[model samples]
Target: MGTFEGLVAFSVTPTRPDESIDEDRLCAHIDTLIAAGVDGIAIFGSTGSIGSFSEAERRRVAEVTTKHVGRRVPVAIGTGAMTTAEAVRLSEHAEKVGADALLVVPITYWPLNEAELCAHYRAIASATQLPIFAYNSPVLTGVDMTPNIIVRLWQDGRVKYLKESARDLLRIPQVKEATEGRLRIFGGRDDSIVEALRLGADGWTSGAANIVPRACRRLFNFANDSQNEFAAHILQRRLAPLMSFLMDKGHVSVCHTALEILGRPIGTPRRPILPLAGEDRIHLEGILRSLEEEL
Candidate 1:
């Protein structure tokens, strides 16, 4: 399909008070992002808590999101699973439901070597024709798919893009160099967007975009505009506090909490991943308020 670029908001699978996937809330949330002019939307990602949902629920989310999005912008479904069989199944489902791309992360109960990782991607890619955006999230997945490994995967023509979330800016150019500018690299952390742009990243994938889509888009536009470096720097400085808060606390929980305070209220995160509370929530409110003044 088409290449994915620009500000792609990493969605939170909005839940009801009972922790069920609230389809109405999810659709409304995506509509908000689309109205804000996001380039794309990624569901069932780490920020969306893909691991928290069952396979059936993931598929339902994919179906609802693709149905709701309806060619407005590309939809990238996270189809990563603990095993190749599950990943293939999810990837096939994503393709069948009209998803534009697949974001596959290496999920392992134990460590995976380079060969095993390669095999994992190869098998999944064979199962679906949708472009694959390999995810490099070592924190949750415990497998840091390196730039070289990613380059190899890209060479095989399966992986078209990479969502690098390791907080290592070096990987941005490293992946580019390894692949000889073949792989589209996206910044994974909100706080790292500026640096990523400076290093020639194609776009950014952010959980915080759920709360501040307009601001995030403006910042990315400024950064990407080349001649507007001065303006981008000013905007980045103004947005730093909120970005810092998101990176410091936790993007998932903070966005969930911030959404509620803004009155959009996507509902609480699922159990075992509690919503932000107490002083942290208060601090987030203050940061968000100040961010509005910057915009």
Candidate 2:
């Protein structure tokens, strides 16, 4: 298994109002992240709106992101599906397309027990040579992979990382202690990146990086340097507002709107998931524009 190290961005796909992936703009978004000096780029992640996309669309995203990233940085793809077989298929395609790793979320629809969840990851790990990071976003997935289960998977040597999105910041230490620091922990909570790192997380998978890559990297760097107070200030002044909109308003909408304000052409979010409207849009655009000015 490859070591999961460094600051990574779970990039949002730039799309049109109709929700089609804007290929050129998407490439530009990748360039934005690379230019910001991020360690890696994770496309089609939860913040990237991967669940709304089809397998073919996700594969295309991975291919494009990998091509643009080249060898400058590692590229991780989110290949989690509702079924083990589908996840394996997506992961195999990612490996074939030269992705560096796979961020696998648990199957969301039919919640599985710890044993079933373990088997799902084991199956995917067995299918591909790429490193696997188990994503535990219980808030979204409706299932939580406890520390014991996480330790078990890590001991198997197939699961290399954990995207801890449980909102329980304290769990970082627990997982680290349980695994003896062997399992790399990544912060999936945008509002608590530095807190997680302070608690022994190796790095972070930031959704805010989609619009504020440099700031995210700066926050991570500052925290790594033990400048907790300074980083927390920045998070409060800048990252926190954007994260609130994403968390309270809508993730994809805020991301798309932020991209627009930044002069990128990531289109509106897909259907069934509506675009930002009313005061939410005004507030999002205002915050983004203010942030752009500051940057």
Candidate 3:
């Protein structure tokens, strides 16, 4: 699996009514993804409700999922915290628990300056031996990283991969050139996967994969093989509607509802992010049914 480049599903973290992680259901979901041929299993990403869970719950997820996965596919912990100290602590825990890599998003309340940003990354990199994924979702994190800051982190060896979640596809080549082709870029935005891969994205870190994994895998396979301009039919037609519809709405909520509709319910999303219902639930079921037919 050298140079393995494909979909790394940003899996949801299922929780009990008390908000504790349902480790049994969680591992089952990971097994489903591995069975579907996903390239990696990334937990605690935005889809995992990264900010809502306590550090202890995250550790349980990291420990249980990594041990359960047993290196079947790579396991990456999104050790994103609001402060450097907390982030570093989580990074140390992830490495200690046998995680393969770290997705270090700048989980900031306020925007960070370039100097502060570089320093934050430097501190995390120094604290862990695992490869870092520069998770850049400016919309949620509120700190859009410039190429120079990203490149500087790469230069310092703090970041080996980037999840460019910026909706703009131009950042693909921009960072590719800035890093001199040394970094691996994974398209993080759901609606942009096909174009992102076409524009030289190394892989995809998708929330939608939690529902329609084989469909996502097919898109990756088609794009990677090139096949003289063969296109991603499943995504362009079946998948894009759901992904795009969820952009302004709840991704985690949609995923949770989709799971229930698919009959592999992983419980509800944590408190405050209510379950998808009524017309929204009906629409998701329709989407899942159509997508399942393709799968």
Candidate 4:
């Protein structure tokens, strides 16, 4: 169930109006992703608003998603939390629920040091047999996983893969060199997929794929499978507007708007993160329509 590679979409957890997880909508959304041919389905990611959920809600989402997916595709569950103990608990619960892999980010307000980061990972690794995908999103997690540290985690056999999201293309090659090809790197942002692959990323962990799965898969195949540089570049260009908005606007909000525009309403985003509105919404729709035609 480990050693996974390819386009893995960070799914947006569909909720009811009251912000409770809508299991029926969530399951249906996953079914669409599997049918669209994503290599894996990741639940409780930033796109899924993992941190916004309570511990109980997170566990429930993991169980329901794993059961509904039913081994159709690899399911990577995000088990990051504010504290080491919470992270371990989430990781253990994820393992107990039959998840194929776990995405762990150093999700704490207090910045973590090199030793603390390693220890946090080691603790979670001890709790689960699932492959660990260390998520390096300094923007969100406040901890940049440097090459040396990433290598150390791999050396300890605690981290099996990396989701590099620093948005610096150079980090791709840096990670490749640091890990000596032992760690498989996945691009975390959609806009950077082509360059990431060109620089040796194994695959992409894209949130945009939730709305445009076919295009994401095509872009990956063109770059990695077909090795068609020209086609890959062209497809990435077509997806750039949506990617740009996602980067400019919040990924979750922009994606939610796109999904609703496409006739798949998953209710409003959880409180404190209102749905997109007005001019930004109009502009996002324009981009979405242009993208739809290209697809």
Supply candidate 2's per-residue lDDT for 104. 92
Error of 1 at 11 (Å): 1.0
TM-score of 2: 0.94
Q: lDDT for every model?
A: 0.88, 0.82, 0.85, 0.87
**Model 3 agreement with the true structure over 81-151: per-residue lDDT tens digits:** 99999899999999999988888899877879999999998999999888898899988889988777888
Rank order (by lDDT, best first):
1, 4, 3, 2
Candidate 1 at 258: error in angstroms?
Answer: 0.5
Return the lDDT, model 3, position 213.
86
Predicted candidate 2 versus true structure: per-residue lDDT over 1-295, tens digit per residue: 2345778888887776567788888888888888998888888788888788888888888888888778778888999998888899999999998888899988577779989998889999999898888899888889999888999899989788889999789999999998888888998888777778888999998888887888887778778885467755665567678777777766677787777766775778887776777887788878877676445
- Candidate 3: which stretches are off by over 4 Å? 1-4
What C-alpha RMSD separates each model from the true structure? Answer: 1.2, 1.8, 1.7, 1.2
User: Candidate 2 lDDT (Cα, whole model)?
Assistant: 0.82
The list of candidate 4 runs beyond 4 A from truth reads 225-227
lDDT of 2 at 260: 70
lDDT of 3 at 211: 82
TM-score of each: 0.97, 0.94, 0.95, 0.97
Candidate 1 residue-wise lDDT, 67-123, digit = tens: 999999999999999989999999999999999999998888999999999999999
